[model samples]
Target chain A: MASNKEDVKLLGMVESPFVSRVDIALKLKGVEYKYEVENLQNKSEFLLKYNPVYKKVPVLVHNGKPISESLVILEYIDETWKQNPILPSDPYKRALARFWSKFIDDKIINAARKALYTHDEKEREKGVEEIEEALHLFENELKGKFFGGDEIGIVDITAVLIAYWLPIIQEAFGAKLFTSDKFPKLYNWSQDFNNHPIVKETLPPRETLMAYYKGHYERHVASNK
Target chain B: MASNKEDVKLLGMVESPFVSRVDIALKLKGVEYKYEVENLQNKSEFLLKYNPVYKKVPVLVHNGKPISESLVILEYIDETWKQNPILPSDPYKRALARFWSKFIDDKIINAARKALYTHDEKEREKGVEEIEEALHLFENELKGKFFGGDEIGIVDITAVLIAYWLPIIQEAFGAKLFTSDKFPKLYNWSQDFNNHPIVKETLPPRETLMAYYKGHYERHVASNK
Candidate 1:
């Protein structure tokens, strides 16, 4: 028998919230994995073969089976190694965390993107409605504390997506979607989340992310004038 | 001594996938609870208090702590009681299942609903593209006869939102988003899933669902015409 541990490989792009979520989860869990930076524009064959359906990154290859999607990978990482527990132990509490996480997963990016990126007045108006609606719900979910009831948990992971990605959108749209004064609870939540030690150390530098998204916005979105 | 059993109550709507996922998980795990049908139109004080943010259904009230969101609830159910294990033990495998489940949670309904409900040619076309794109990813993810690989797992529970809801959509749109000829794998997945005794029994009656949706769709979407 070989006395070697199998390597954990992560196929990810730096700019993606989906990919970054996985990275944060891995760090939170304290797992070491090899990283392959995937260019989404010109996807690698291995990526295509591994995740042919989505053609997206943040695929975790363990042993041989390839796992796609960030949250999926997060669960896998949390379970495989028992380090930092990302989810709460109580059933009802865990469920509450997952519910909002899923809500954030569904609403945070896709719903906001079209509106923020659109040149059309109608689409942009719809985007604004969606953004405002999302912020309203987000403010409500914050509950004047963390998403996991006065502690950081899965909803915290998801809330970070908006905190991290919204700046990019704020720049792209030339408007402020998340105002600290307007949604004070949510504002505090973002500040508290970013202040967490594990998160503080691992997060992608803000300036780097800003530079990356600036280029990404101008080139990819054809009608975003 | 007073009753030791917790005050376990589930706030749900009849035709809600979010509600149904938690119900099925609770039932499968042999957990007992009270069911309250929430009138989403007129928000209840309890719902507002329990799920203050979304004020949505499927808020599992256990010992008085309320949990919202279906996926989160499922994980909570799996962790708290530890019966049938809706999520697997291995982290990597569980994450993979969740990733696919989240993808479904995020994309599936929008894709199908847009195709079935929207009247605008461009909107409908965009919906079609989203549905087809989502399907390609699903097809890749669904390698096992079941989404859980052997038994129905959390991904299956999450995917059930599609399995149950699509049939209703299919009824409304006879053009059929998921015929045997089109989404063969999902078609089979849906059949196998719905046929399972636990699932088959758990679902709402088809005729009632169709009628309810007919009115819901017509009244809500003025653009549907």
Candidate 2:
């Protein structure tokens, strides 16, 4: 690993899976950086200035230049730091990785969010069905131990939500969508991914995440009533 | 330009701006390839097979390996054929380009689509407002002759819809959202973009697209009534 001297700062909310994705990427690359926790409810001026468009977390500021959006930031990190490359080297394989990463973002995460967060019963049911169908398609793409073969690549990093947050949200809300039996490959992959030393170290404590999601579930139920 | 020997096939619909984005990228790269039209309403089995996840057009098949999504295809083309690079050489600039490209897809295009296609009056009004807001932010990003600083890069290519199709759709639907006076920079960029030789040659004929969108507008109105 290359010794880093560049000034890198991550503006993030600790509980965000998106933030964790950036954190994990930095850890994987062995890049040293400053971490600033942003209170999402009351976003800091620095966060807003860095990411004026979205005003969202997981904004990676490198040498004073800010890059928002976790996936975009991941690509930036991969391109900037050549060590422990996250994406495949081949152009075609890289394209495939980008495709699946996008699928996880556009379809799987969106559906999962709806399933866990939406107040409408019908929409939640539709979200559950949609997530199941999307997961099956994603499951078919998993031919190896990790989406990046033996190593956790961009697709696996992008799918941090599936490995860590989804189960917590599912359990917190008492939603029964993703299961070991229903998606054995994905389940196994998730277990392997979560158990990875880097991932295990980088991820927030399970009990903290559980309490956070459980609070969200409680609030959701209260509002729905 | 490197002499092309690889078999490249693009399965696309004539009227789609997304497909046109890929077409223009290939043309810019000077890559000779086969074009296979797919009727979206009655999709070809080949397209379904290649892009089973999305089942959408603009699937670039390079040496029998399929890559779907226009932006993904654009990056693949840039990487595969290094002749005329579409993205920036620098990582931060590339991230900025990716960010704007995504903003175009996620915010501007979605709002433009809803404004042009939605049957609901309230939704259409909201879409119009949203697109105007989104376009203003995009306009601020324009500091050079083109988004690529003299060449039409990925961000400009991704904004093909805003350039070639939006005017036609606006006219066809008799909606007034994107205007030169309101968004002079974006409007100028659109004009410069559409007037480019490759873009002009690759885009579907004006009359054909106008008629197509007009038909859609008529049907939308009829259905609402």
Best by lDDT: 2
What does candidate 1's lDDT look like per residue over B1-225, in tens digits? Answer: 114576779999988877888888887887888898889888789999998766798898888888877777777778777768887777666666677777776688778778767778799888988887787668666888888887888888887767887767566656466667778898889889988888888888888788888876666466544
Clash pairs, model 1 backbone: A72-B95, A76-B91, A76-B92, A95-B72, A95-B73, A98-B72, A99-B69
Candidate 1 lDDT over A118-206, as tens digits, reads: 66779878887887788787777676467766665667776777766785657754667777777777877788888788778767788
What number of clashing residue pairs does each candidate have, in the order they appear? 7, 0
Off-target runs (Cα >4 Å) in candidate 1 are: A1-4, A110-115, A120-157, A162-165, A168-173, A179-201, A216-225, B1-4, B122-145, B183-189, B216-225
- Pairs clashing within candidate 2: none
lDDT of 2 at B208: 92
Docking class of 1: medium
TM-score, model 1 to reference: 0.82
Shift in Å, residue B26, candidate 2: 0.1
Among incorrect, acceptable, medium and high, the docking class of model 2 is high
Residues A1-225, candidate 2: write the lDDT tens digits: 445568999999778999999999999999999999999889999999999999999999998999999989999999999999999999999999999999988999889989888988899889999999999999999999999999999999989999888888899999888899999999999999999999999999989989989999999889978
Q: List the global CA lDDT of all models.
A: 0.76, 0.92
What DockQ does each candidate score versus the true complex, computed on alpha carbons? 0.60, 0.94
